[model samples]
Target: MSGYDIVKTRETLIMALKQDDEKAWAVFYELYAPVIINFARKRGCPKELAEDVLQETTMVLMRYLKNFQYDRKKGRFKSLLFKITESKVIDAFRRAGKISRLRNSELFSKATSEDHARIITERENIWDNEWKTMILRESLQEAKKRVNSRVFKCFEEVYLKEKSVEEVAEQLKVSPNLLAQNKFRVMKIIVDTAKKMIHNLEKS
Candidate 1:
């Protein structure tokens, strides 16, 4: 799920989906599971509902693989995952409303109150932060393994710990100029890696 040697891209996903490959299924799950879960939870779903949404969305992709063809023109796979999460979350809400008269529950209403609005806002912010962190952490971990340890150490000091280039140069006994170069080097690694992973996600 988090590696840098991968060559599989969007075309690979389409081929895998058409053939129903297990590796393709795993790749698809790795890319979108956290996104769907976080998206559902951010939309006020309970934890169980968030998980259910993730599962349902995955099944929808697997079962209806032929129903919706992959198209970059439709948008990136991240957007497609959000669409899937939104649809599943709404379906859950509608089903819950049908079963529970508490669609209008006081506790649910309180979620919109000024006093509780802060809570809802904070929850959404936390979820967004977590989602971004998940992607960055995965990217960092994969990038770390692929590149030189010394270069990654410079990156950790400068970007991960917010150290100044001067500080990193002093700590690593490297020239500031070299530190700056390493920063770009690490950035390129992560950006390229994540783009590949994220672009092909949600395909199946």
Candidate 2:
């Protein structure tokens, strides 16, 4: 993640898309196609059906992106993507007869309405969790690259490996106080980087 510039990356991609730049479109697909496909798979869609949903989702975005407005206060671009994906997932379920009728607990009760609101909430939760996890992971990686190698190793030993502060400090031949300071410094870098990435992603 070294040298990564998320804000510049997003702006370039968006500008390329606005201009119908083929290379930018390809890069966009490479970055997001797998994420959307995995999201569908996590929602219980079969592999083939998930791929179909992804294709449909991409087509929809392509068709409408020219007219799409970017408004961070209203929502993020990714949220718009998830909304489209949700609809496609629902359409897939309907086509497969999964939503033809909702039934109560097995062995005999009257039909019930599908809880679409609950479904949407669940999917949104999934999306939010995944998105945050991705941002944090990338941030940590970038922080690792930017920090002093020894200090990062000490932080990793203490925080990531769950070692006692005294144990790791002794092992690394550094004072416990110094190790603690390194951990704090590295953790701050990771948190700050993640915040910046999230802000860039949310920018209109």
Candidate 3:
């Protein structure tokens, strides 16, 4: 498969998960662990705490996923996973006494309904940012696999590393115009691939 193999539908995966299938659990971890870790880190968790959240969230998923009722009308799988991961992060902070500091904040102690809504929106933004980041990274990896290796390297240098385009063009002995074309072409592939992944993620 060029990108993530979308072989398992959400329903099929859930059924396998409910059966205690080891492979299904492994797939679940590989797909979601990074999102959980990044979500925690973005929420101000330390490295250790973020890792703890990953472990705790994994356990929680294993315990509860077997009985999960998948209903797209209610929410997507990511939303359910986000709620569990967010809960684990809060528990980690509570244990580390960080929640106490947050609790003492005026925003926490004297927040209005609007204030609470803002907090929820901010967290949702963080989650979406991390999710999209992961999608882009995976999409880029798939693009790399399909693109000419040397051209892709040049694209990375000029586009991602933000090196002087003139310098990179001279070193690579390619025209700046050629580099520009490569950038545009490779970016199109990445964006297209990411869109497919996002569609699957939301609908699977």
Candidate 4:
């Protein structure tokens, strides 16, 4: 489901979570678990290990959930979650002996607060990109369901497939102007949906 489909605001979800609402926790997990798992896999963990990392990260988040405070100036909640996931990734690598010196290295062992912040910022960037991509994809899927099939097809042909407008118009047996209109209409829906999804995600 698109983030737009989630009715509760981020604050509401967090409040419910604090109250030990099972539904809220489930919704929270559904929203973020895939991204966390994908981040681990992208960082080179195998699928099985990635899944393990996700579990470990989720448990850590649950333990510390109540301590979280929403402060946009500091960062989004995803940034904190990304930090936890990054820690888990390091732990996984350490366990596998992939980075034998990481634990004793200056970066981890004697890092200044600034160094840790820089590392977290880098991980947050990766998390943000993945989250945006997922939201955009979900928004596109949601927009497709709401738009006319022909209009969506026009969007696919002109934007996604990069077909010449004239070619697509000819194939669709429609005037160039009509095809262009369809493409514009579908594009608008997609962009609007994506914006909404991003807004909701950032708030969350």
Against the true structure, whose TM-score is highest?
3
Determine which window of 10 residues in candidate 3 has minimal summed lDDT: 1-10
Candidates ranked by TM-score, best first?
Answer: 3, 4, 2, 1
Give the alpha carbon lDDT tens digit for every residue of 106-196 in model 3: 8688888998889899998999888888778877887788799887988899989999989999988999999888888889988888887
How many backbone collisions does model 4 have? Answer: 0
- TM-score for each candidate, following the candidate numbering: 0.68, 0.74, 0.82, 0.77
lDDT at residue 112 of model 4 (Cα atoms): 85
Candidate 1 segments whose C-alpha is farther than 4 A from its true place: 1-10, 66-80, 98-138, 194-204
Clashing pairs in 2: none
Error of 4 at 162 (Å): 1.6
Per-model lDDT = 0.70, 0.75, 0.80, 0.77
Model 1 RMSD vs true structure: 5.4
What TM-score, to 2 decimals, does candidate 3 have? 0.82
Write candidate 1's Cα lDDT for 1-204 as tens digits. 432233244355545655687776776566557767777777778999989998998877766666656566776555555566667887998877832654567776555568567855665465456556666766787778877999999888999899889878988999999998888999998888667655544333
lDDT of 4 by residue, 106-162 (tens): 768888899878977876777877787777676687778988888898889998999
lDDT of candidate model 2 versus the reference: 0.75
lDDT winner between candidates 1 and 2: 2
Model 3 deviation from the true structure expressed as Cα RMSD, one decimal place: 3.0
